[model samples]
Target: MTSGLDARIRLSRGPVELEVALTAEAGEIIGILGPNGGGKTTTILALAGVLPLEDGHVAVAGGEWEHAGARRLAPEQRSVGLMLADPLLFPHLTALDNVAYGPRSRGSHRTTARERARTELASVGLTEHLGSRPRQLSSGQAARVALARALATDPDLLLLDEPLAALDPETRARTRSDLAARLAPYEGVTVLVTHDPLDALTLADRLVFIEDGRVTQVGTPTEVLREPRTPYVATVVGLNLYAAQSDSSGTLTLVGGARLVTADSTAGSVWATVSPHSVVLHRERPEGSARNAWPMRVSDVTLQGQSARVSLTGPLDLIAEVTLASVASLTVHVGTDLWASVKATEVFTYPR
Candidate 1:
C-alpha cells in the first residue's frame, strides 16, 4: 500500500511556542488554512528540515525524518518536494535543464534526466517551452516549469506553499486548473498550504484548520465549510457560528438568551454554526417547521454574481447569501426589516 506523510512539529522562538500535527495520505492533498502568524509557515519549515524541532517528530513514507527524541534526518535525504509561491528558477538554465536538475542531482545521467524531464514538463503542458529561459517564459509558464522540476524527483511527498500566489488573477486561475490536473496522476501525499478558500476548495480533499499556532479543526472541504469551529474559522469560511449552551433535555439557548430547540442532544457550553446561505429572508414570518427566527434590518448589501450577499445587523451581525431573483422579489434594500428563519438542524451544534 502507498504510504503517507505524518508530522508533529513543536518549537519555540522566544516566548512563542508553536506545536502542530499533520498527516496526508497517499494521493491526498491536505490544505493547511490559517491567518498570518498562525504558525502555518513555521510548520512547513519544520517539515522541510529548515527549522529545528524543539519537540515532536516528522515521518514521511513511514520513515522517520525528524524528532527531538531521535536523530534528525538531513533535508536532502527525505523524499519530499517543496514548491514555494515564487518559482525561484535558475536564471541561466533553460526550462528543460531546470526540470532535469533534480534527477541529475540524484545520479541520473544528464541525457536520461533530460528525457525524463521532457515527460514531466509535457505533463504540465510546458513541452513546447522547454528551451525557454526563465525570462523568456510567462509567469504561468515559469510556475508550471517549477512544478515540473519539483515533481521530477519523484518524491514521496509534495509540499506546496501558496504555489499560485505569485501569478496574476487570470493566470492564477488557469494555472490552478492545470496544476490540479497535473496532480491527479501523482501517487504521493501532497500538503498544500494556502489561505484562499477557492484554492483550498478546489485542490484539497480535506482541510486542517490552524489558528493561534494550534489546529482547530480538520475535515473535508465541504464539511469544514458547512461547520466552522471558532468565530475566526466561521468568519474565514464565511459562516456565522455562536457559542451556545443547552440543557440535558435538548432545550438549547443562545449565549445572548435567544431561545431555540436543537435537534442535537447535548449539555453545557457548545457551538451553534449556521451558514448565511441557509438563512431565508421573509417579509413576514413564513410558515415552516424551522424553530428559529430573527427580525433583522439590512445593514449592507453587495451583489455576488447571480446571488446577493446581504449583511444584517441586529442580534448578530451576520451575512446572508441570497439569489438575485430573491433580491428583486423581496426588495431587500438597506434599512429594510425582514424575518430570518434558520432550521434547528441547520444550526449545527458541536462541543466547545
Candidate 2:
C-alpha cells in the first residue's frame, strides 16, 4: 500500500515514557485503543508535531516531518487537522468564520476562505447554521461544525482525539454517524483515538491496541474481536480471559494454580478465553461430561441489557452471562454457592 503515515517515536516526560510505531495507507482510518495513560494521545500529538519525539521519525504523505531527533516542521507547518474531545471553537466567532479560520490562516483571501467554509459546512449538513455561534448550537451541531472546520483546511492527515466524547449518548450516536459520512470521501489518513468501542468498530478500517507505552495488537475489528491477545482487549470484547501454563497432557495450570483440562494443549505460557455465554452454573455437581468444573461463589451480579453478568470467585475467577429467565429459575444471587462448568472445546487456548 502507498504510505500515507509512517512513524516510530519515543518520548519521555519525567516518569512517563512512550514508544510506538504506526503506519497507514492513504484513505485508511486507524483506531487507537488503549487503557488510560497508555500513550494513545501521546502518539497523536507526536504525529501532529505538537509533541517532540526524543528519538525516531515521522513521515506523512511521503514528506518528512521529524527525523533523527530533529523536527522539520511545527504543528502548523505540517498539513494536519486536529480535533479534540472539546470542540475548542473560538467562542467569539460565528460558525462560518470558525470554519473559515483554517483556510484564512493558510493564505486564502477573505471571500475564498468563506466560500470554502460554506462548502465544508454544507458537506457536514451545517449549511443552515453557518451564522450560529458556538453557544447557540446544540452539542451535536457544534461537533459537526468542528468537523467542518477541520476538513476545510484540506489536510493530508486528520487526528481525532475522542471527538465524540463530550456528547450525550443519543447525540454521540447521531454525531458519530455524521462524522463517518464526512470521513468516507476524504482521501487522507485518519487516526482516531477513542475509548468507545462502538466508534472504533464502526468507523475504523483497522484497530491498534496499546498498553504500558507499547503496542500489543493490531488488526481489523473483526479479527481483534474474535481473538483478543491482552486482558484489556478481552474485557473490552466481553470475554473471560486467563493466563496459564499448558502441558502436553492437555492440562492447563492458571496463574493462581487453578487447573483446567482443554481439548487442545501445548507447552509454555498461553492465554485461554471463554465466552460468558458458554459458562454453565449449577446449584450442585452437574451430571455431565464437561471437562472443567469448579465450585464457585457468586461475588456480584449485574444486569447488562437483557442478560445478567454473574461474577464468580473460586478456583478460578470467571464471568458468566445468563438470561433473566435463567436467573429467576436458578435463584442466582450474591454469596450463593454454585458449580460452574465449561466443555473442554469451549476453552480456546493460544500461545502468549
Give me the overall lDDT of model 2.
Answer: 0.91
Q: What stretches of model 2 exceed 4 Å from their correct place?
A: 265-268, 328-334
**Best-fitting candidate, scored by lDDT:** 2
Error of 2 at 118 (Å): 1.9
- Score each candidate by Cα lDDT: 0.86, 0.91
List the candidate 1 regions with Cα displacement exceeding 4 Å: 14-16, 247-251, 261-269, 281-291, 295-303, 324-339, 343-346, 350-352
Error of 2 at 97 (Å): 1.7
Candidate 1's displacement at residue 125, Å, is 1.4
Residue 352 CA displacement from its true place in model 1, Å: 4.5
- Tens digit of lDDT per residue, candidate 1, span 236-327? 78888888788876667777777666778878888877788888899997788878788889999999789999998776666899999998
Error (Å) of candidate 1 at residue 308 is: 3.1
